[model samples]
Target: MPQLDKDLISQPELWSLVMQLSDRRLTAALLPPVDGEQMILSHIPLPVATAGSYAKAVEEAVYDNPLLLSDFSRIGLLTSSPRVALIPACLDDKAAEEAFEATFGSEACVSLREPTWREAVVVSDDDEQLLAFFRRTFFNITIRPTLAAMIECYRADGLWVSCEDAVIRWVYNLDGNLMAANSFDISAPEDAAYYVAALRRVVGADRGTVYLRRAGASREWCAAMADMLRGASCPVEMVNASPAICRLGHSGADLPDYFLQA
Candidate 1:
């Protein structure tokens, strides 16, 4: 087992526990209540085989990390699923459910309305047991789609991309309003760049910065993406994690920019 953060265990109520569940791994960050630093940044690789195995993997990971057992002031869970869609916020409950089912083909979903974005984010995952485990373990756990955080943090006119393993999540904001929030599965940097260019053309965003999250991305990948975007006259900028979201004693030098923006 890895060394646990003493502060996180000793003063659990002073911090906020944030966990991100993605297709590749489960990332957990113990952040301060306000704009401070992170107490712990840890992750465990998730088995990609089945949902039952996934729940079991998460259970083992939580048990392995003693700090995760602490009761924090706030708990947020970000679910990174490709089965996420954005619908108008004005839709009624039945209408929203129909829309979600039309796209995702299932009713096992959670819809969150973001008044700022003027849309509702619908995230669907078949891992009911995994979600149940989280609800059963934590109190008042706030679960949301990962893209919702990007939409909240980045409120400018640009393209924000977060790369992780074989998945690429992106949000396009135009004139300080969210226009698109989506993800794609890619095998290489070029595949992401291609989608970026295509989105720019489709959205008519000819000249806006493309901010890439510095965490979980390689220098080579960033460089290649920058090179590709340069042809479209769009400059690519790498955004680092906020200083307020740093590690316990050290700076959040290696953390993702979207740590706890939600």
Candidate 2:
């Protein structure tokens, strides 16, 4: 039987640890169920370049652990690799496909089609590490509840990003539907301009309510991104609450099925 060391963690503390580990590039994380049917986030240290092997290890780790098999439903992968692309529903399938191919090649990691948006979760890291992981383990292993959950956590959407030393996360209510996700490298000076441009292109001109989450150390980067969004006329709110708190409290929190439906 495979055994994973479990710890009972509070919402606040868990977010702190997420930020810390994200800084170290342990982008993908697991939220395992604990007593009382609660969930506690956990991470296994796997360097970005070793994602393929990491996925194999995860398969082995959950091979016999019923708790992991039942509870480890969602996996969050943080990367500064291939940036994210969000295609609006307005685009026809052909146009959407072209746009996705142009931004990210055919070997994108996570591709999700929603009623309102089509997202390409591209992994642009060296040697296509994430792509190999997906091909070797993602299909064979049952990870997320659906493709939506996979990208929501596993890839970069408007929701989250883990840059060099900080993770910038966002959640938004879009036309009565909420999409929250995060990815990295968007805040770094070298990467910020491209990230901002991609973000604006995906979101377009909309009256969406958005909330930003980041560590204190990441305040500057977060503010920079926020300022850029506002410049593009995005109605974004830099909330005082932590990302973990917001994610855990809300009904669709933690990438639950309710969130996907919403």
Candidate 3:
């Protein structure tokens, strides 16, 4: 159970809630109304090795902190599963399912088209209970792939990487065209640097800058990444949350940049 501010408990309609569920943890952020100061954030770790544990953890968190039960102006649910495949939007349901299974072994999944990028994103997770829980608990909730927000935020010509938990989601744009949008599991700074270098080679994006979103990474880790990229002649720049989200006043200065997504 996490402690939340009093005002947030009293007036819920004035805020917007964003919840992100990953393999290792679930994160929830309460975005206050413009110029308001009471913002709340919570992170609950999931027992990854057990089946049906994700939903159990989420239910426990909600039970402890009823703030999650509040009715907000809007709610966004983001899933950060690594088992994601991006395909052309023209594919039909059957074809999309085939494509997803070909890339990742056959599994239950959902496919949604991202109109902004003109591509269809296929996401698969084995946790059926977790999906059911959200559907039963929240009203009019918008479920989206976390990659969609990352791509929406970096629509220019550059390489962008957003580090959250132990996963790094990256996108590359060249000449206003999206070259790649994918994620990788990284355990060390060296691993991240290696992926950046490999992605540059694979995408031929050797000249543009590398933008990094230090969502859940530490200062020491970010600094180490910057040093490594600079040594490779790739300029590194840190990206913060959207200006609109910043204006709403967040609990942490280093909140993930994908909160507002535009």
Each prediction's TM-score against the native?
0.84, 0.42, 0.88
- Candidate 3 off by > 4 Å: 1-8, 36-38, 47-52, 111-115, 119-126, 250-252
Candidate 3, TM-score vs. the true structure?
A: 0.88
lDDT of 1 by residue, 5-100 (tens): 444466788888888887667788777654444456777776547546667777776776777778889898887766667777777777877887
Candidate 2 C-alpha lDDT tens digits along 83-183: 34544556776676677668767764334344323333322223344335533543333222122332443222333332223333333334434443434
Give stretches of model 1 more than 4 Å off. 2-8, 32-38, 48-52, 106-116, 246-251
Off by over 4 Å in 2: 1-3, 6-39, 47-54, 57-66, 71-83, 105-110, 115-165, 170-212, 215-238, 242-262
Residue 242's lDDT in candidate 3: 62
Q: Is candidate 2 or 3 superior in TM-score?
A: 3
Find the candidate with the highest TM-score and give its number: 3
- Compose the digit string of candidate 3's lDDT tens values, residues 93-145: 78878877888777646544344464545344435666667778889887777
Ten contiguous residues with the weakest lDDT in model 2: 12-21
Best by lDDT: 3
Instruction: Using TM-score as the measure, name the better of candidate 1 and candidate 3.
Output: 3
